[model samples]
Target: MPIAFTVTYAVFAFILGSVIGSFLNVVILRTPEKMSIVTEPSHCFSCGHRLAWYDMFPIFSYIFLRGRCRYCGEKFSPRYMVVELITAVIYCLSYLVFAVFQPADWWKIAFSAVMFPVLIVLSMIDIDRFEIPYWCSAVMAVLGIAAIFVFPSEIVWYERLIAMGVILVLFAVLVLIGGMGGGDMQLMIGASLLLGYRVFAGLLIGILFGAIYGSIKKLRDSKAEKQLTEQIRDIAEQWYKNQLDRGVGYVADERSDVIVGSISDGAPDIEWEFLDEKVWVGLPDKSELSRMLRQNITDEREGGFKIFISGADVKKVKYSRRMVFGPFLAVGIAVSWFVGAQIVDWYTNLF
Candidate 1:
């Protein structure tokens, strides 16, 4: 409880977070690729130059390097540095909230400290790839299961079970209805076990943020959607026409070696690259395709062009394939863990 001890722990938390964050950069970059996280040394993405230890020292390394590759001089993204800073903050805050600032529970602090990196992994992986890695959720479930024995809350065991069951049901419905991915549901289920009734607060917060972002994104994407309407229609028309005229099939998935598919089979086959089958129609018209294909946005708002000429007019369509829920759900989970008890209490007090 001494001020000196609290400061020391906070410092330790920040330093540890920075080191973990450095490793997390590798995890984020490699996991989606199925690359071994431990085998590969850190290297310049643009050039095959291996980085030294000093070059990998978290935030300071980025600052020293001026955000450019020291070997290739290619300007790298600041996101790596941002990740480290965010991780540092998360650890520092976790210690302060669970240990120093609030109840000095080392157990809670340890749980949260572990949670900080797991969350960073989840959030970054989701952002980089629209899909959430099952392993992250698995780790989370393991942590939650451990919590049942290690740091059980005051909530009745039955209540915790009911809350987790309720959340699982709700998430199952959402997944079946097609708004969310199974991974998000799995993460929620784990979170529910750890958070109990408080998981509702997390869901609410997640939904709120997802909606707000979806709304903003919808507005921004409207133009791209408008442009894509013609492009999709044109591609579909050409593709169908080619099939009709030639009586042959050019599979959508394989247009070229470099380009995986005309539009890369809806599931991200490659990272940071898009191969639209429309290119086969002719050289792809960039005007029709938004640069942000990694978003895994199959269609935009205002209904994408109908791929098939059917009962519905080609011009008329419906918005399908909304935003990714993983990142938003992560946001909610973090917020809930931090303040869900307070939120639940405040709501209950109003009754």
Candidate 2:
């Protein structure tokens, strides 16, 4: 419990965290692309310059190189530095708060330290790709199961099981209602098994943050759409005019001007992955529509031919974009891991 010992362990934690953060950057970049994380050497995305040893020293390298590739001079995103710094600081804080305070409590600190990278990877991957890797959730669930055997938790065994069941059912309902994603549900189930009733605090915290963020995002997207819709509409209008000149006229109340033969309007639109299941042969652009219109001119006797695109496809392009929830849930999970017991204790005391 000496001050000197605490400082030394904190420093060690920071170094360890920085190293892990460096590896996590690679995972975040490659995992979504299905690229080999270990075999592939780190290279500049723009210039394809393989990073030298000196250029790969986590936060320091980014700083010394002025956040640019050493060879190509292409500036790197500040995210690299932020990730390293956040990880280092969190690790240091974990050591000082949980480990150093009680020399015998290294296990708790170790668990928290290990979870940092997992949460970071999940958050970043979710940001990049809307899907959360099932493996991450499985790892979390496995850790929870291990904790049940290895550590003595205050929450009873049945409570953990019940919590897991409740969360799964509740989140399944939310997913059906479009309030949550399938990935978020999986994560919550894992978290519930790990944290028991205290997982509710995590859900509350996550939903609190998510709702605030969702509001901001909704407003931002709405404003951007207002500006962007005008521009895209101008293009669409020009495209429609071109189609009209090619003997394709407007329908009575059609959603889109350009249509393809294979796609259907009546079928279920969004697949479970939240992607429109269509191989985009070409855009519904002016030139493409004109070509298609001319090609489909076999029915010239039936007045001006009109191509009616599926409303779903039109909405996917102009109106729909999936919202991300994994990052918020990950944040909640991290918070719950750190202080869920404390939160429960404080709440009980309040009563």
Candidate 3:
């Protein structure tokens, strides 16, 4: 009987999780794009066709559709299936930790279920854009504070204060050193509120995960750089040989414009024309070059005048699913274990 009940619960939780995860997919994509997640019906971005009920069935729908839009025939990213599957796993695990373990009050179980989705959304947003919007973090912080009061085995206010204070200070130092972003600082504060002293464990884990991630990325980047350099050298050598065969005198002059051109049937094919003249070289051409010139001029115009327009190197950023999902899973399991133990003790005392 117990075995049957556990199986039923797991299946139910999986379905529920997949549904919630489907909603989360909408939030993750729409929120960063500043679009209405609720108001906009699930539709094909390519064809603008509204998704039918069958087409909206979370993970199964994607599989049945063969990962293509029904109306537009546009291929959907496999990430849709990946997100739904991940959410389903999180949901099932939360249920296993809460329901099977018998936590102190059903409230904590409900709260864990709700918090997991929020964490998933925020983590994805941070990974995608590297920014946690003020409103989302603020709301999470407020809710975490409120959870402390609502739960049966309540954490003291001082403990909450201590956790928040310690994380805020640590995050401040990180931000000062340019090690973390302001959004990360806010996220840490919210996490501290939720996890209390356990936040230290989370912080240590996050740092270790971040370090491993950075190392792997650095190796990949080094390989890519080496390949690009070799490719560029080969192209340059071929260009020089072609110039010699054509009897063209190539002079590397600092004052003159450097026009990198190709010859197709002995006709000059200008690939790029780099002008080394003054930055402000009169008005721009009123064609395709006008758009390019306008963008450059705008950047130059704002360079010294804008307070935020500092010269900073930009790099491509990527996020690992394990890093984002792992902490939340750890915290949820920890909280569930603590609450479940208290519940077991209380039940034992009743006998």
Candidate that would win on lDDT: 1
Per-model TM values vs. the true structure:
0.79, 0.75, 0.65
**What overall lDDT, based on C-alpha atoms, would model 3 receive against the true structure?**
0.59
Q: Write the per-residue lDDT of candidate 2 for residues 133-227, one digit (tens) a residue.
A: 88888878877776676565557778888989999888988898775778888888888878888898888889889999988887866765454
Q: Residues 213-259, candidate 1: write the lDDT tens digits.
A: 88888898777666654555554455445453563533233232122
lDDT of 3 by residue, 1-351 (tens): 378988998998899999988988999899877899788788888889999888879899899889999888899988777778878987887777666766434665676677677777776776565556676667668766876887426567777679899988888897776446687777667767776666665666567666676677657656544443343334334443444355353323222223322222212223333433242123112233233223333211100010010112111212111123233433443443345335445556999
TM-score for candidate 2, residues paired by index: 0.75
Best-fitting candidate, scored by TM-score: 1
Model 1 misplacement above 4 A: 237-315, 319-322
Q: Sort by TM-score, best first.
A: 1, 2, 3
Better of 2 and 3 by TM-score: 2
lDDT of 2: 0.69
Off by over 4 Å in 3: 152-154, 223-351
- Two-way TM-score contest, 1 vs 2, winner: 1
Worst 10 residues of 3 by lDDT: 301-310
Instruction: Give per-residue lDDT, candidate 1, residue 205.
Output: 88
